[model samples]
Target: MKRVTSLLILVTMYFSIACQPTLEETNSQLREEVIAVHDEVMPMMGKLKSFEKQAQEKIAKLEQEENVDEARVEELKALAFDLNKAYDGMFVWMRQYEVEDGDKSPEEVESYLKEQLVLVSKVNEDITAALEKAERVIGA
Candidate 1:
């Protein structure tokens, strides 16, 4: 009975291991996901800059107007700051990023890609949030 149980355990372990994705496959998938998130948000940097410019112009115009709302001007300034920070974050990440070479081990590649995935995803979220906030403020 014990021998049978041991054999079953070994077979189960083998099947489980076989079902799991290889490190290279995992790395490739992670790399693709990271790149996808980055590509999705990259073009938004330009849009964010344009919005910032518009907000700055609005603030400037408000400053020169009679009975201008200082609170509104401050809100626009805050929105522009957020947009700038988000845009700069992406640019800096791109500038500092190094492409993984074939010489890297599968484990190393996977680790690096996983880290990048987190970073890219966060940047995407930040940019999206900033854009949404800007739209809300502008629409109001």
Candidate 2:
């Protein structure tokens, strides 16, 4: 009876250890989270271009007039630039991003995922802010 109990305990411990998530698994989860954040913001890309176009069209119309509101035109110009910049940031990040483990160590993979999360978060913020600014200027 004693021997059987010990064997059972050893088997249980082994299974428990084996069932735990490895560092690579944890890193894979982190990578998924990074991709999730990216996916959440990607659909807004078209709005960036649309808002930029509106800003440009407004600027053009204002520029053709003799009594142009320079302040408003400048604001629109800045907004347009911001929108385009945010749009470009997404593509740049995507181009630079890599998910393949390659020959990287687990620690290195974790570090890379953490860095990518931060970068994508910043890009997400830029996108949100630019879109909000556009909506405000374009009247909802």
Candidate 3:
């Protein structure tokens, strides 16, 4: 009888502890979601930067050459269309995730600002890379 009672107590304690949520688990989940959004959107931002640089280069080439490259302009415009579509799609998912996560609270907002700042920094590096490529392509 004593052994049965002890076993029951042990099982109850194990179940209770297993059901409890840990701070680490919650944080890891949040981090996973944030990383997923970053992964989803960062590439789109890079594509935008690439399109912007390509458009700038085409504009410069059209300016410098005696005859404008209508084909390059059309190509750039097509890239712009694709870039806009990608940005819109990525942003829709991002906003939905943010809303569902309820990250609009002051503290959450502050955290988001910090994370976004880091993301912006990374994107700026990508933009710079695109700009360098554009400069090389345009001989400028």
State residue 57's C-alpha deviation in candidate 2, in Å.
Answer: 0.1
Better of 1 and 2 by lDDT: 2
Residue 7 in model 3: shift from native, Å? 20
Report the Cα lDDT for candidate 1. 0.88
Ranking by lDDT: 2, 1, 3
* Candidate 3, 98-136: lDDT as tens digits: 434363555565466457545544544544454454444
Alpha carbon lDDT of each predicted model: 0.88, 0.96, 0.58
Summed backbone clashes in each candidate are 0, 0, 0
Clashes of 2: 0
**TM-score to true structure, per model:** 0.84, 0.86, 0.38
lDDT of 2 by residue, 16-95 (tens): 99999999899989999999999999999999999999999999999999999999999999999999999999999999
Best by TM-score: 2
**Candidates 1 and 3 compared by lDDT, better number:** 1
Q: Whose TM-score is higher: candidate 1's or candidate 3's?
A: 1
Q: What is the C-alpha RMSD of each candidate to the true structure, in Å?
A: 2.4, 2.6, 8.6
